[model samples]
Target: MPASAAKSTIALIGVPLELGAGAAGTVMGPAALRTAGLRAAIAGLGHHVVDEGDMDVPHAVPEFAPGELANCRNLSDVAAWTGEIHDRALSLLASGALPIFMGGDHSIAMGTISAVSRFCAEAGRRLVVLWLDAHADFNTPATSPSGNMHGMSVAFLCGEPSLTPVLGERAFPALAAGDIHLFGVRSVDAEERRTLVERGVDCVDMRMIDEFGMSALLRGILDGLDPETTHLHVSFDVDFLDPELAPGTGTTVPGGATYREAHLVMEMLHDSGLVRSLDIVELNPFLDDRGKSARVAVDLVGSLFGRSIVHRPSPRA
Candidate 1:
């Protein structure tokens, strides 16, 4: 634990549905995070922390027509989780507590982001998503090499036609392409790369981080926001950290953010006071080395909620 900051209610909702990923262990992610003391870390920062225990696996709805999206694996199960999460997320947002969605996999964003998008629209605010991940996650079904639904979450949230039905009659206000900023990206599928450029999505790849540094690049993103009218949702994928530091996730990629570099990003986001919601995804504990990854993730979340080594004046002040 570090120093405490302002008091706020922080709700932890665990989504344990991992049918969207290409691996078996992400379903254990939520429990790993809890065991790593995620709730206590935030509470140590003077926030009122509520632990809404892991959500039960939703009953798969028989909503998809046969062969509608044949390429996507576990399509119906993913759709069920998406719809259930969207409803739960919307209710949490309405309660006014900052929600940290502890995920089973990255695919849960299809629901969480959709809820945030709707909430922002109703409040007349712009929703800007800072997607911190190793992969862009912008692939459509046609473009995905592995057919894993987790790979297509960003595309689905942006209203890719084929995935719209995943929400199944839920109100979805598609996020604008410009509102999304993908950071820490290093591995992008070929067609996913093309789609990202064509859609004009803002991406700060690892090469850019290496060239410009995290502070300068992140400041460019933070400087453009209007704190009064924007809701910042941070979707943090564990693979964004270098594999050497956090080797828990199944989708480990080389040359990711170092420990201090990741902390700087979180510290900066905390100072901005613009983060309204967050997702910590893709921690597959079975792949971890003696719970190392979960502890790192909890520490990062602590920084995001205003834990620091020394008292620093608020940049907003």
Candidate 2:
């Protein structure tokens, strides 16, 4: 383990939220990750790992009018989960332990990143989100063809007006579009793409990766951050991996990061020591080929936390 990672405390928060997606099995994502030894993997890398169990949706939630946000699937359920997730995430961030939000789907990010943005603002730090996914989740209610909340999470985090009430009465600092960097994206809706361009979201799609290479593109992101004042949040949707590598995710896109490429990304992140929070989302065990995807996720996380083949001097040292 790198010196920066040694003896660090890591909190694992399971969110069994599948309402944001169009699939049912994503509800089991947290369990699959646990079954794959997520705790042991991090602990083995010399971190103190705390399993915070799972967060359940609030039973009583605000009721919305029938025609209000009607296109969004399971609006009420997602609202309940989002509020609960935001509160819990805020508490976790304040605790000084690095939190890894194990997710039911990418929608959980709406809460996690919201909490991060708020924390960064209060702490006088800039929040930079590195969105690792096959799709740029920049869809709003009006732009989303499927109206899945998972697809709309980034927009909500970026302060899309219509979805503001999803977090209920809580006022979280919305992320600036320039602070978001979408990586490994190969699939994007037409309107979502337009929105991403119009909003000036930094999207490093597969074509860009092929041209510039992952290390160069990723370095361009990491090197630009002012480490002293930046709170880096990495939202890693499992579908960021090639569907052939991680077919267990609900929204699998074909051309995604390769195994070695994924490890390099993790290793680089570990070297940078800029990551303060993480989200491992969109793993559906029911669709997994005998837990293969879960194991891969665990391995990548291991690298992220400093599980390396050989010891390398810390770059910051």
Candidate 3:
């Protein structure tokens, strides 16, 4: 059983700009989450909510080295953003507040997770990541064809050399390769596929979702968690859901988890109480209609914070 973080203060820190991804519109995700009433929702659960507001991220226009993968672009600004987020995340952890990182893109995980890793290393606790995304996101400079940094978040976090300098003095802290779990993956490039396979990464893809349903997958992941783990950061890319359910993401994959399926995962996560931090990334409001995607994401986060569908009791005739 994991020690509950009930007494901890929760901070909603938004990185409301996206130069780190292949598309636009996700920069609006931070505001969307707040507009969807994140602070109020979390407070509804009897927890104190504090909105630290958005972090200081650079504009998408590039200034730094695009590096070996020129196509990925934004390398310099992304690196600088890492430094900014690293400082903020470290402060949040030291302050004992459970920081819920509102994302501009998945790239910020490289910063948030890295800070958590460093804290855990010194304080003596394990770091666990539940990477729930549609794509594998393991691409490196050599392996990546498109060179998008969002596609390489997992690769960078695992201490891949292509992103070392981006670690920015925080390189000493990182998680063991086996501690990360890649769940709900369906799309994979040839290089990412090979790397994930060779690294012995635990990936429960859409096929598995089809074969066993979400309950079994949740059971397997929860079973792997321990209370001693310092933090369980859930990096949820909206693309993990089928485009039918979540259509506003940069990367849209077919056959995603239905609403009920997504709700169940969040509900179970709430039950486990292992999750500490989170990322709601890849939601592109520019591509959405009447804020459909934003609303769904809000509902899902509600489930994570202990909202349920069984609020009413069945009546007998």
Candidate 4:
């Protein structure tokens, strides 16, 4: 059979995180996307699909009150979710299926990405992260004012200290600075910005996208990827969309990537065929204009799986 004729399996795991942001509505992300038929939609593309449902994250009735900078209000809940999802993802991969985590919050990236990294590492494969977000999420407990774990997810994934323990006894999945690529970033703390620059992470900010054109900048990004060399994880934050299109996101940023630009990125990713995992994070349907944000998210996932422009999951030869 031809390589392109092979089909693949995709498992959906939802992570609803209301503990990581100020706007307080992302916990509903999983259900929202699900209600929008995230599962059936992907399955319709002719891939094997399994809805693992949502991970059970306990409420964070804090044992101790949190401080200003140590904003660990829901530390236990987030940590527990991290542990459970890590194992869940690993378990799913062991079943020979790719995992697509429907996120509760951006903080959950710690678990979802870490699990995929460990899986690839054990299999002697390298992992690449395509971080699509408005903020860098590279803050540390010491540096963050809000201490929202979501704000600090990227920093921890790249081997920063303070919270690697969330991966359980096994180590957190850390990456080489060059392996992680950040796109459409418009907001960054001064310290996080400095850290990202010092570490040499590939960040194509909104200004860079505007200056160079999305297609040109994206070409450079795609050219940098060696599909044969990587298992890509795309972490798409709802905030990555302009508020006009995805208003459900808690951290709505103005002047985000337009709908067309967003689709182009997904299409390129599909063409590369390097994506092995995905995350649809930070959708706060409470703020949504109907179900517009969730629909767009589903559409983007559709593009990643191959829509009219790209085509569904092809076999890895």
The per-prediction CA RMSD against the true structure, in angstroms, equals 2.3, 1.5, 4.1, 3.1
- Model 4 lDDT per residue over 58-91, tens place: 5433232344334554677777777777788889
Error of 4 at 242 (Å): 0.4
Which ten-residue region of model 3 has the weakest summed lDDT?
Answer: 308-317
State the TM-score for model 3: 0.91
* Tens digits of per-residue lDDT for model 2, 1-317: 32234568999999998989988888888899999999999999889999999987679777888664788888888988998898899999899989999998899999899989888889999899999999898888788889899999999999998899899788988888788999999999999988888999999999999998999999999996766677789999999999899889888888899999999999998888788999999999989999999999999999999899999865744
Predictions in order: lDDT: 0.90, 0.89, 0.79, 0.80
Per-prediction TM-score: 0.97, 0.97, 0.91, 0.91
Give every collision pair in model 4.
Answer: 15-104, 16-104, 17-104
**Residue range 1-317, candidate 3, lDDT tens digits:** 34233434688999865777888888898888888788888888777889998986545423545556565566777777877777788899888887888887888888888888887787777788889899888898788776668888888888887678776566656556678888889899988888888888888899998999898877887775665555688888888877888888888988888899998888777767687778788878888767778788888887877677675221110
**Where in model 2 is the C-alpha error above 4 Å?**
1-6, 66-68
Instruction: Rank the models by lDDT, top first.
Output: 1, 2, 4, 3
In candidate 2, position 146 carries an lDDT of 91
Collision count of model 1: 0
Using lDDT as the measure, name the better of candidate 2 and candidate 3. Answer: 2
Identify the superior model by TM-score, candidate 2 or candidate 3: 2
Candidate with the larger TM-score of 3 and 4 = 3
Candidate 4's C-alpha runs over 4 A off are: 1-6, 58-69, 309-317
TM-score of 1: 0.97
What local lDDT score does residue 240 receive in model 3, on the 0 to 100 scale? 81
TM-score-sorted candidate list, best first: 2, 1, 3, 4
